[model samples]
Target: MRIGELSRQTGTSTRSLRYYEQRGLITAHRDHNGYRRYDHDVIHVVKNLRRLLGAGLSIDDIHQFGTCVRALDLDATPCASALEVYEQRLRTLDTKIDTLNHLRANLAEHTKDLRQRLRAK
Candidate 1:
């Protein structure tokens, strides 16, 4: 399909698709009319890329594992650094959760105080 179709299907912007191509995470062929044509398999790859991004991976991190994987003749393992990246993300998420819980408790206490003040008034 064309870039527009891929964008619509994947819920990604055309620019992001192009950026992925530039980052070596995906590829497309150029038609005679200069339009980029992507294969059906790209949908799966794009979804995986989206998952990796959602998991807090940078483009550089994805690129590190992507290029070698794309070369059909080679059978390289996935990037070992990904485990560290996932661990870091998990740690960050844990910190955020703790911070949010603390804030929620503070807010709940403030809300009770406000209720009591309103009742007194």
Candidate 2:
């Protein structure tokens, strides 16, 4: 099918599809008329791209997924590469959470000190 058909089927913009091509997330062959033609398998790939992007995965992260990205479908199973990326992201989020909790505790103590000082005044 053509880029337009793929876009309509996946509900993704043609511009995004082009960008995905440029980023090496997908590929399309040019026809004699210079129109971009994609394979039927691309429909699933595009859907996975949108899902990964929505889940906060970067293009680089998707690239890291390699063939694993293409393997995504209705099946609830994610490939090992996908698992690695998610684990890394989880660790990063955990670090951020710990930092925020430390800051919150410090702010609470400061607020308590200010309240006690105001009462003394």
Candidate 3:
């Protein structure tokens, strides 16, 4: 199918598809008329890409493990690299959560102090 059809089917913007192509996250072939053509399975790939992005995976991270995911979907083959990537992302998320919790605690303390001062006034 053509780029427009892919975008419509995937509910993704044409610009984002182009960006994905440029970023090498997705591949397309150019027809003789210079139109971008994609395989039908690209819809699944795009959906997976969007899901990964929504999960906070960067384009670089996706590039690292995307082929593994595609193989798993298309051939029922599993790749160990995907596990490594997931583990790394989990660790990163855990660290971020710890930092955010600390910040929230500090913010709560400051808010309590402000509330006490307001009560005194």
Candidate 4:
């Protein structure tokens, strides 16, 4: 199908599709008129790409998926490399969450102190 059709079907913008092609995440053939031609299976690919992006995986991290990128929808587990990337990203997120929680606790303590002082005044 054409770029516009793919965008409509996938609910993704044509710009994103082109970016996917430019980023080596997906491919398209150019017709004689210079219009992009995508295969039917591109729908699945686009969905998988969106899923990965939603999962907080960067485009570079998605490249580590290898063939698993195409198999994201399969019932089978992803390849080990993809699993490794997922694990790493999880650790990173956990660390950030922990840091945020610590900051929030400090902020809350400061607010409580200010409120108590204000009440005394």
Go through the candidates in order and give each one's C-alpha lDDT: 0.78, 0.90, 0.85, 0.90
lDDT of 3 by residue, 56-79 (tens): 888888888857645526336666
Comparing 1 and 3 by lDDT, which wins?
3
- Per-residue lDDT tens digits for candidate 4, residues 33-100, read 99999999889889888988987999999988877778747447647898799899999999999999
Off by over 4 Å in 3: 72-77
Off by over 4 Å in 2: 72-78, 108-121
Candidate maximizing TM-score: 4
Candidate 3 overall Cα lDDT vs. reference?
0.85
Q: How many backbone clashes does candidate 3 have?
A: 0
Q: Rank the candidates by lDDT, best first.
A: 2, 4, 3, 1
**Candidate 2 CA-lDDT value:** 0.90
| Residue 103 lDDT, candidate 3, scale 0-100 | 100
| Cα lDDT for residue 27, candidate 3 | 90
Candidate 1: the clashing residue pairs are none
Task: Give the 10-residue window scoring lowest on summed lDDT in candidate 3.
Answer: 68-77
Q: Using TM-score as the measure, name the better of candidate 2 and candidate 4.
A: 4
Q: Judge candidate 2 at residue 107 and give its lDDT.
A: 100
